[model samples]
Target: MLGFIESVFLVLTITEFILGNLVNGFIVSINGGHWFKSKKISLSDFIITSLALFRIFLLWIIFIDNLIIVFSYHTHDSGIMMQLIDIFWTFTSHFNIWLISCLSVFYCLKIASFSHPSFLWLKWRASRVVVGMLWGALLFSCVCTMSLMNEFKIYSALTRSEDSPNMTEYSRLKRQEYNLMHVLGNLWKIPSLTVSLIAYFLLLLSLGKHRQQMQQYSIGSRDQSTEAHKRAMRIIFSFLLFFLLYFLSFLILASSRFLPETKIARLIGVVITMSYLVGDSLILIFCNNKLKQTFVAMLPCECGYPQPASKGPFAS
Candidate 1:
């Protein structure tokens, strides 16, 4: 039964990874298609396309890492592949988080209405703000990855001299370096999380105000614009929920490192982490009309997926 479960887990993980890549690839392809037809793409499309690209690479690293962990448990050595995985994982994961936050801020700026001078200023400079955020994310990710890679090189060198006369000292130094690097990695994640939290809070405030204003109007008097606002609010809430679940699962996964014997907790964490890309992309596709239409058309006829009629809840 234990073996059976592990096999099932591996299969599910690989399946989700493949599905996520396909979905993200579809997103990138469609965006590319649009760019080819039209000379320009919107800022939202630019962010979404770049986000999908990062997620594709991230999912690839995750799938490879999970395969090694699950199928090659006897391999205790941390070699160059592991080092690459650590660096790429850190870079891609941070990049993905930052992009999501940028998307959230973009949405809030586009959807929310506020009379404050700051709000007006932000609304005017939303494009520049997103571009700045993207560059900042890239710079931070690069720094974190390079720092980790440097530590990893030292760790790898120490690992190679396991049988040396000073083996004990080397091991101690490696452990200390690893711990410091881990802490630094966690520190690098702080800004992304802070940005995301701020965006989420601002979106929540906007949604609340919009809801209250809508409530003042009669249902019979609500227009398409009101419906669009409600749809945007729902997408923001859905994204927030996804991020909350992801962070909770990430904490659990990180703690599992200390409880090496708790395979179940680690397994659950891996599964949740792997699902984030596919799950979030699905949310985005369903919320966006163009992506939804393209995705639905690509589905097999036997799947019985209904064509979306108009831009509403499930329609897009």
Candidate 2:
């Protein structure tokens, strides 16, 4: 039987899974529908759509892995299944994070008022640049997946040699192997995190510079360009906040292996990670004008309830 904490974690994971899928699905459908009719999509929309699509798969992979872990006692051949799950999880997660980083880069190039020759040159070729980044991300994921599979093979071989004479030594070695695998699993995320942080700081710097220029030109009135900078800043800031939380939760969950009592900490980590999946999508929907409009229109109107006015800083 599952413990109380485990039961709660299960429920929360399911709730977030469902909510994350809905918001991500909404993003895909809206952008997809527009593309189908128009036969084209903006580079930013294309990236967002692809990111949402990968996130849907990533969420399913995560949910399935969680279920397997929770019920491993009742299951046979779980190790092989887990190995397969890890492969898919790694690929999907890599795509998700790298795409987000690409989005940040896209935002910086498109919106940031930079006059540097290199920045202007990249902005002019933004679509090709993002495509190249996506391909590079795919190549990197392939390498990481191959490395993980190799590790899994070695670990499986160790497990299969359980009849060895040095049982104590085997146990210690197994523990060490497990720890090494854990670290290897998480190490791939660091590059993506670094890229995202760099893009975020660049956006921040651009926003600051843009604001300074606006202050000098304006006569106590905000202009459209100023509002654009603010909106972009908000979106990127939210992404940075959620991405950092997600990364931190992974670290906490990884540390749970060394702690004597880890159920609570592990559960907390899982919850926060799931929150990032759901919360980031919600922020994107609310902050993007088309998404917000479509989301509000989809809600059923009540006779007496006041509909939210569309006039806000978020409005495009």
Candidate 3:
């Protein structure tokens, strides 16, 4: 289940995303494409797009690490590989959450009304600095969490336990460490989710206001408005689905640990995290019409699938 073969598939996923972004990266360099034809391509758009690409790249790394861990479970019980595995495990999990948070922030910026004027100075500025700050925020949080991480002794047999002979009375701090780490890890999620909800509400109100005018406008404009609404709806629905499933799983996880009585609750927690991670790409792709087209086009043209090319909502 784990070996060079699985590693290859992991590489495939990363390569696929890298290729996808590079194709889109053209939108940034040598005349950024019509991805945002409705508005001028400014530094913000460039940064947002770049951040989106970076987030996907992070996901690829996390997936590849998971595959490596899967392989290690069956391969030789080692010293070097074990240390690498532990570091990868901590890094992937922490960075994954941070990247997702950044994505959510970028999406909010894209949909919100712009107030800043597009100046050449701003447009030509560096985007990497902003991205680095976002990542730094996540890195800080992850580092803070290390202080609270629960520790258990690992043996050459690939087994870990707090109750093992190696875990002496002096080392018993599982309950305290678990609670601290869990709380710190989930703390950022609250503000991220809150911002999303507030932004969504404002978005709904704005959409509602546009609806009345959409009826009075000319046929061409009205059709455009209608299409825009549809696109907004797709994004909103995707966000809602993600929030519902993710929050439910988070609640179960917290409850299980806090209550310490419901064994099923812990299992449900694992299921939720797994489902959310695997489905993250699907959620993003399905929410954006243009992204979906890119996906279909990357597949063999011989299949003749109906990959709808989109720029704006009304792109036909």
> Ten-residue segment with the worst summed lDDT in candidate 1?
307-316
Tens digits of per-residue lDDT for model 3, 1-316: 4456545544554555454445434323322455445456544344435534444454454444444444443342245554454354445444544444444444434443333564223323324433764668567556744633332232322243444677554334554554455544455456546645654664565566666666666434445544555565555556557656766765665566566544445444434544554455455554555555555667676465565444552121
lDDT per residue (tens digit) for residues 1-316 in model 2: 8988788889999999999999999999998999999998777788888988888888887788667656663442236786787689778877788888888877777777788898899989987998899899889888877777667776676676565666777767886787667665777888988877777777778777877776787744366655666777778788888988988887777677677866566667777877888898888788777787788778887234344444433442
Query: Tens-digit lDDT track for model 1 on 1-316?
Result: 2487678878888888989998899999998889888979888888888989999998888788777767775451366676777778888887888888788778777766788999989989988988888898889788877777677777766767665775788777776766555544565666766776676677667667766776777444355545655666676677667776777666665565456665656567678877878899888887887787777777786364565444542231
- Using TM-score, rank the candidates from best to worst: 2, 1, 3
Maximum-lDDT candidate:
2
Backbone clashes, candidate 3:
3
Q: Which candidate wins on TM-score?
A: 2
In candidate 3, list every pair of residues with a backbone clash. Answer: 2-71, 27-32, 27-33
Tell me each candidate's TM-score: 0.82, 0.88, 0.52
Every candidate's lDDT: 0.74, 0.77, 0.48
The residue pairs in collision within model 2 are: none
User: Could you give the C-alpha RMSD of every candidate to the true structure, in order shown?
Assistant: 3.8, 3.3, 8.6
